[model samples]
Target chain A: MLRGICLEVPPGALVRIEGGNGGGKSTLLRLVAGIDAPTEGRVGGRPPRTAYVPERFPVALPLTALSYLTHLGRVHGLGRAEAARRAAHWLDRFGAAGHARTPMAELSKGTSQKVAVVQALLAGPDLLVLDEAWTGLDARARSELDLAVAERTAAGAAVVFVDHDPARLAGVSDAHYRVEGTGLAPVAPVAPVVPAVAPGSRVRIRAAAAPGSVLPPGLSGRPGPDGAVVLTVDAARSDEVLRTLLGARPPWHVRTVEELP
Target chain B: MTALLRYQGALLLRSQRWLAPFVAYAAFVAVGIRPGDPVLDSLGYAAAGLVPLAAWLVRICVTNEPGAARDCAAAAAGPVRVHAAALLTGLAGALLTGALAAAAALLVCDRAATGPGAAAVAGALVTVVCALTGSAVGALSGRPLVRRRGYGILAAALGSLLALVLAPSPARGAVSALVSGARSGTAEVPLTALAVALALAAATGTAACLAAARRG
Candidate 1:
């Protein structure tokens, strides 16, 4: 039973939701996805093309994966051929294209999850809400979903997700909120964690913007105690991120630069 | 809306959940109507059988999708729309069954009692009235309204029984008109009953759709 909760997800933003079991995180996601209407107050600005993945995909539907996704794509307002094309593409991307003709009930758990994820991604929705959507995925599919989330946000869509894994999309999320006892509290964004990159290949930059000045849209990081921000970027892109910071009007002051061993 | 309907229709068809109610309706028609039966009486019996069959079919469609799949569809298309689509699919299936039964009765029953054309038209209207009334019972008996499978089925059975026997029910009025018309050897369209059933179904559908969104 959440109350007095207000969240705004801007275009291209990735919002991560954290909470204990039965903390209303799923409830909040459902409201955001427009699956369940709030009894009080209002959830506005929901795009018509919103898609959601529920926490569990334990279904024994008679439909084959491809047909189900195609139907969902159509429900999302795609033409039949276009819907089928996109469904096949997403299925293949998730490595479940081989199971396209298999009945959903006969598919393995991981494959069923892939189909669930594919349905949401196929339509390219403006708002994507996921509740523990990666729970049953294999390692490869999990990373694929991470990439899919990144791609969605990169394409200027708002993505809201809840997962048991704290490290999932840790650094890439634009904002974090915890549902605590019927109220929402914002948690400071964490430093980006790029798992594929070795420790030696990462760079950390510390900078502080002038008071009343906002950071560049492309730069995101954790807030330091003294009002400074620490951004961790790929070593290759550190120079570009720094150039944007220093090149701004009344430019940010770069306090320190370091390489992690 | 069309897409939703198509998806729901596919779910109904592919799931094979339609078999039970459909076979039940067919059995009811086969047992109640005979080749030598009066045309109007047989048509009335066939239409009356549709009330329970429609209610059962709507229940199946409304609850066919698992919770997670339903949520997915609800998110893609609003929950109200998903619920409405399920209701319409079940109603459409019931209507189709009702038409087939009525046509079979027109073929086998003795048509000498009344003009075949008028009887066919009247049977079609009466079929519509019963199907709409059954749909109303169905929409109110499933999912958000009843929730429990045992209680929902019980409600549907009782609701269908009441819709058939209760004097105020549009289905009852329409079926009675057809049965009495068999005696008078005349066809009655039951237009007023049809209007009432339509309104009843619309109200029931609106209530069910709102409940789906709220309860979800």
Candidate 2:
């Protein structure tokens, strides 16, 4: 139901699409991916090789993750042996190698999402369309996808992605567009805020977790002299680390957070 | 195209959807063989069975597309290529079924055949044609039975069966004629029906590809 939207994605650029719920984001991606044709105005210059990662992965087919990726790789014109190699490579890259033999219907949400991203990246598509593809990934895999996006653009491919996080690709976006009122409007870019600190400056946070409880992912900590967990984190990512700790299942209760002199 | 064909073949094999249907259809055709009937008669039964097998394949390949695969491959391979691959995969399945039916007919149901080898060839051809016709009709329908879930595929199979069975078509009789391996008269289908089936396969296959591409 897009009304008036004119967008240009140049080669070697990263474009981000932003919109609230039901703002025609997915529909626009569909049309851009050539899955749906535009009704009135024409869409021009779509590359011959393109790949899309939908927000939801359809995993009911009776296929293993590797088998599905191999099929799609072949669909993108890779030979059998090459397709199998890339399938296994990408699965391993995304930590889904263990699930290569697992049926599509049996994968967990995070692992299934990894397979979804792997398939899109398998053939090195010229145009990559991602619709909230980062929603369910783990921290490492999510950043790995960040690196993957950078690598795709570096290789002269255009990437269009929608992620729920505003902080996503903060400094890397070549252009930003917002979906509004049945169409799209360009969003003015804002300079990223990088809090200047001494190169060696670090942040320390002390917390207490229940006995035998594991620390949350992306946070490293050890027991202090008083038995409270003393966590050391890079000053830049301290907030994220702290949030992750607080958001842990058992909830690491912070006793103190300070900068070590 | 070759890679896509191979990919599809591998995907279909991995899915194993064809196993149950193939086994069931084979058993059904075997049971229908009367000991005294012409070995070629079983071919008609096999050809008839091929219609459902083909329709079922179409349902699996065309109707049950993964949203991720469909979207991801659409722009890369184009809808035309993707849909063609799926339909061609169905064609491959049909050919395999046809070959199997031929072997079974020649081995277990050989009575009126002039030569086992010739009868086998005729049986395979008729089976393949019936399947092509079945898949073409389903592709042309433009309705993806997957929208209906369990009932959709069942409905597609039954509907194809009905269209093939009730049309007073010379298809079944024509299969019998071809498999009879007579050197002269009535050994082939009327050119009109053959022409129609060929045209339908071409036209409807292209249309089905377009329809699949257009779908969300």
Candidate 3:
């Protein structure tokens, strides 16, 4: 039931999509990952080299874990020996070395999830779309995943992941947006109240210098019900406001607050 | 084409569990057919009968995963022609395997009467036809329209017809005519017919690949 939702994720950033079940969170991930198309609206962006791990693990055949991973690498255009070597290395790192030669079907659910994670990581894609990727991992495995993701981001890869446990990704994510009613709205930052200004009271603004820059066009400031001024500053005048505000002497307090629409 | 051949061959070898039993059954049928002056006729019949079986195997391989048809479309390979070449190569392997089984049976029956060269050529030709037909049918099995009762009816009718045509016949004129024609060194029919069949098969397989690629 989604409609006309648009979002732009910047390069080299981690985006966390949070929402209740049956709310199209997975659908959005699938669309972004290029696994599915949007019913309406156009999605435009560079087709980032991406790897997607679905909520349900898809293991091809009953081949050994190493064999399957190696095959996946080859499918993605990796050479034979190099694919094998990389797969082996990741398997060992994910504590799956002992089961490397074992058929994938024989592995437990948690073990299979570990293999999926290593496969996605080994691809080293420009974007990683994960759907509940942390569902069945042990604590150590989870830590390894965090380190791996951090390393990827440091090396300039973007990631979008969906997880039920928000606490696990608290500090790792750069931005978190919840899917609500076919659209996304940023999670507003909590603002500290200014006790100095009473609600419903009008304050006169002393010239303070006869409007040094004529308050540049398209720059308007209005007070909200909570007595906080919301400034719709034009991008061209943003630098002017910053210069004027920051250059002011003591007794002047400036706090930037973002509002959710 | 090389990649497709190598991948299909590896898959075949790894999934030897089901194929091994099938190969055994084919061997049993090949041996059970008695050898005599009518052996060539019997072989022609047997080769034709194998068409449906070959088709079933191809169907299993292609449709093993419900999503495979769609996945195949999305593969980042070059043109659809390349995929078509690969599929044909894989089918060739399957056909060759069947031909080998038939050749083994012919060798065991009467090496003196059935020269190795003739057996090889005939087996190869028959295998090629069966393999192509089988692959085409298998490809259709994944189509929504064919997945219905229509495909079932078609399969049953085709299977029954092949079995009947391949059944041994000791009839006089047509059988004698074919045998004499085969021996008279009139190589044109078999050679030309095989070449034409192979060309058609390649074209059809290519078409299927292109369709899949476009859909993907």
Q: Rate the local accuracy (lDDT) of all candidates.
A: 0.92, 0.76, 0.57
Give candidate 3 misplaced runs (Cα > 4 Å).
A1-11, A18-24, A34-49, A58-60, A168-261, B1-11, B24-33, B36-43, B63-93, B105-119, B143-216
In the range A101-191, model 1's lDDT, one tens digit per residue, is 9999998878888888998999999999999999999879899999999999999999999999987898788999999999999998765
TM-score per candidate, chains pooled:
0.86, 0.81, 0.63
Of the two candidates 1 and 3, the one with more favorable TM-score, higher being better, is 1
Q: Whose DockQ is higher: candidate 2's or candidate 3's?
A: 2
Error of 2 at B117 (Å): 6.8
DockQ of 3: 0.05
Better model by DockQ: candidate 1 vs candidate 2:
1
> In candidate 2, which residue ranges exceed 4 Å CA deviation?
A193-261, B108-122, B140-146, B150-158, B165-173, B176-186, B189-191
Q: Please give the ranking of all candidate structures by lDDT, highest first, separated by commas.
A: 1, 2, 3
Which regions of candidate 1 fall more than 4 Å away from where they truly are? Answer: A191-261
- Residue B203, model 1: Cα distance from true site in angstroms: 0.5
Task: In candidate 2, list every pair of residues with a backbone clash.
Answer: B39-B109
Instruction: Please provide, for model 3 over B124-214, each residue's C-alpha lDDT reduced to its tens digit, 9 standing for 90 to 100.
Output: 5655555555555544443321445567547634643543354221112222333454455321125444554456456656665655443
What would the per-residue lDDT of candidate 2 be over residues A116-169, giving only the tens digit for each residue?
899899999889999999988998899999999999999999999898899899
- Model 1 residue A164 lDDT score: 92
Candidate No. with top lDDT:
1
**Residue B94 lDDT (model 1):** 93
| Pick by TM-score: 2 or 3, better one | 2
